[model samples]
Target: MSAKKNDDRKSVVVVGGGAAGVNIARPLSFKLDATKYALVLINPRPFRVLLPATLRMVVSDADNLGTTALVPYDKIFHAENGTFLQDSVRSIQEKSLTLGSGQEVPYDILILASGLSWTDPIAFPDSAEDTKAYLVRNHEKFAQAGSYLLAGGGAVGCELAGELKDIWPEKEVTIMHKQRLLFNDTYTDRYRRSAANHLTARGVTLHLDDTVEGLPAEAGPATVLTKGGLKLSADLVLKTTGPTHPNTDFIPSFDADALTPAGFVKVKPTLQLLNHPNIFAAGDIIEWNEQKQAIKAGAHAKLVVQNVLGYISGNGSSLKTYKTGFEAILVTNGKRGGISYFGVLWGLIFGGWFTALLKSKSLLVPMFRKESGLV
Candidate 1:
């Protein structure tokens, strides 16, 4: 450690404690010389709410399930514990941050791990207060209503619908995919067929090649008006329509244009921000042509930490990287069990409970929690 930085409390602060952030912070804290390097993690939540398994949580009262787990800041970051700030980030000024409460925290290096945001009523505002309120209330209504019409048959939408079917077979669950279901032309047809066949076999109404023109204006529980004018109503409308990069409004005056056009911090193979060497980022929130999967996000976080340590040690060239062409997609289809869409055989298929055991069965939440220091 440089005597200068050691005296100055050279530290790393990771923003956003979810997915990539936690993964990065854990290892960095693990590697650091406690007396020389300080690690800090900041997020609004007191604990980590394992996402990806959110589907299982919403499907039923399985909050007690292993993957649907959450834990306080103290649980992880065990040794030389990083500072956990439960506040939103208002802006990032170089290696420093301006918290939502107006407090400023400076870091010798920064990791921006804030993940992606969901696209829906609570997130994207399609209308004013009344209209927005109308849309959001539908989520609450649908949760109790049991019957659901999920819009945008993407990963979140499809998984949620499938899990709901698994939990409440009696309820009608329909998915609206604007294109062919999982139009990931990346996978072979065999794998897609197995996964699709499984979901459809569960009475999941796959409404492909359709779009929701709009929702009925009246509040109390409404129907979705399709492009073809077919009216379909359900207990709720869970629109897993899309996801977008988290807000980086702090970028403009701060070398904003230095990032990818998609606003992700552009980094070298080392994952260091190309413009601000001390700043780095990883996760679905990033704008790499990188795949946006939880495992990949965690992998990216590990790379960032390794490179940051290299940067600290003046051995930046030795940082890690994500393996090229790494693709693994696992899904569960309620009654039909599950399937795998992955590499080598490309769209090679797997079957039954074994398929469900892949990532979706809690995204390795139990494993992460164990790794995070809780036995």
Candidate 2:
């Protein structure tokens, strides 16, 4: 962490260095006037984890996948105007933030991009080495397991099943989702069916509308009992039922009404907190009616950048409003197969070839590396 220089410049502090946080901080580092503002980004981790490629990393022995996924934050700032602090925020006040190290950082502008709290296989350990070791352990366990049971038929669950089948074709793989469709009802039935068919063609079993009752905590041979009284046997069990909640426990201390019942921050069209103009939020933490993808979080960052700069420019009236555009998602089955859906023109869905060429081939690892200044 860089020592804060004694200056009169106002501070612009950004919390959480994930996709949305980095996107907002990186641009502000260049665009924000250093003479008028001191930019700082606070995150617990030293590196950003490429979440989209994590499933492939755990299922395959591709060493480079893990290496490339965890990008360092050394080169995120273009100059000396910005500082990256590897610290977690303990609480947030009206005009300042208290970190876990007992240091209080005052800010004229604050952006919350804390994202969500995910389980293992999707979420990794803090340090790069620990995360790599964790992935290696899971990979070994996956190799040794004779069968796999994945709870929830969302993107993560489907992708993990595909990766497992791709690696061990003879291994029995089963997906149990409470919903009838693989994805949520936000997508067309035709698109969801197509995605399910792709997985089924690979001999992946689907147990739709059946909820798993008790999920095993450890990886071992066990029989999982579902709510529908189905006894499923598997050597390993993984849960991809999405994140537990938005990481906003500290927000209620500052403003109780700022968060929704689900704990996500309530933001205006400009992505600013409803009652606090100086505070803004993006990523999965924001109350946006769209798919919580990294791409959408990046879009939120861009808009927040424009609005934050505009707010400080003494022209707050002209802040741009964020409008949720068409819903689009690309679900990768494995390294060479997947599905793509664009909710436009009565919903257009693409098959494996297009998805493979677009996302499955490299999982956009190279693009993220370049964006993080690794390339």
Candidate 3:
């Protein structure tokens, strides 16, 4: 790690280890020549979260969420060229990052792929041991609760409510969302109607165009009040409607223009920062006007890697452009059934027990393991 040896290579530092960060860093670590490039990935968590499988873990019957989704960094990145550090960035400069430990890492190229933050089970635990405890605690809670209230009509809330009703049919389950329709604006009316019908058929109650104000003070058998004055009682209440903040607060006060009006990093079509060409971004952190799905994030990472390599090779003219296309989502209602919208051209809602077979059975654990080089 001598200064002279390090000076011979270009430092490529990537902040965050979420979907976009890991995907971008793994490829670069494997492809970049060690003598010419230094790849370093920084993340606060010990392990990256597999968000697609988290909802199931929240309501799963399993004692522990076996390593199906959570893949460690050591298994994913190449040792020769990749370096993973568990640290949080405190501040950022034009070409360097100051971590929480007060250590500054200078980089010739920076990639900001730290995705958005989320609540409890949806987000990964800070350590390996904590992840196991979280799964066990949620399993016990789900078993003990007699009634459940899910507040949100988004994919998470709907899917969770569906899972609850399917598992414990005798238990009372209610879902409240501000939107009249399920899912988000990206989905079509046909798909929306299908989800609503399926959930109702599964014996799950729906409260559309309603907002919950707050929960009762009593911990046991609390009554939940809505903004519209509707009241209901449930043993356990889960709020899936919290405000999500981007992890870009580390940016120095001088370079405030890098952030957009909504606080997301503004990136060009090539995924490079709007104001800084040496910096690139992808995933939920970037101000890309599209659904923040894994598919889109993966695509963004591919273009970002290509553009970053071109810039490092002194050939920026070959940068690729990113286009936001039709919205696609494979939403599972529960373990038994689900609905999906593949693309605009497809124009058909795919639902039923077979759709669940594609994901719910194992949450794509084998596929993720193969991608992470665990196999």
Against the hidden true structure, what lDDT does model 3 obtain? Answer: 0.78
Each candidate structure's TM-score, on Cα atoms with residue i matched to residue i, is 0.85, 0.96, 0.93
- Sorting all predicted structures by TM-score, with the top scorer first, yields 2, 3, 1
The superposed Cα distance between candidate 2 and the true structure at residue 320, in angstroms, equals 0.8
Question: What is the per-residue lDDT of model 2 for residues 129-244, given as tens digits with 9 covering 90 to 100?
Answer: 78878988988888989998988899989989888888889999999999988989999999999999999999999999999887887656788899999998888888878788
Residue-by-residue lDDT tens digits, candidate 3, 117-231? 8764465567889878777787788889999887787888877876787678888888888987987777787888788888888888899988878653322456778888888
Q: Best-fitting candidate, measured by lDDT?
A: 2
Model 1 misplacement above 4 A: 1-7, 63-68, 119-143, 215-220, 321-323, 334-336, 359-363
By lDDT, the candidates rank as 2, 3, 1
Worst 10 residues of 2 by lDDT: 1-10
Question: Where does candidate 3 have its weakest 10-residue lDDT segment?
Answer: 214-223
Per-residue lDDT value at 309 in model 2: 93
> For candidate 1, what is the lDDT?
0.68
Steric clash pairs (candidate 2):
none
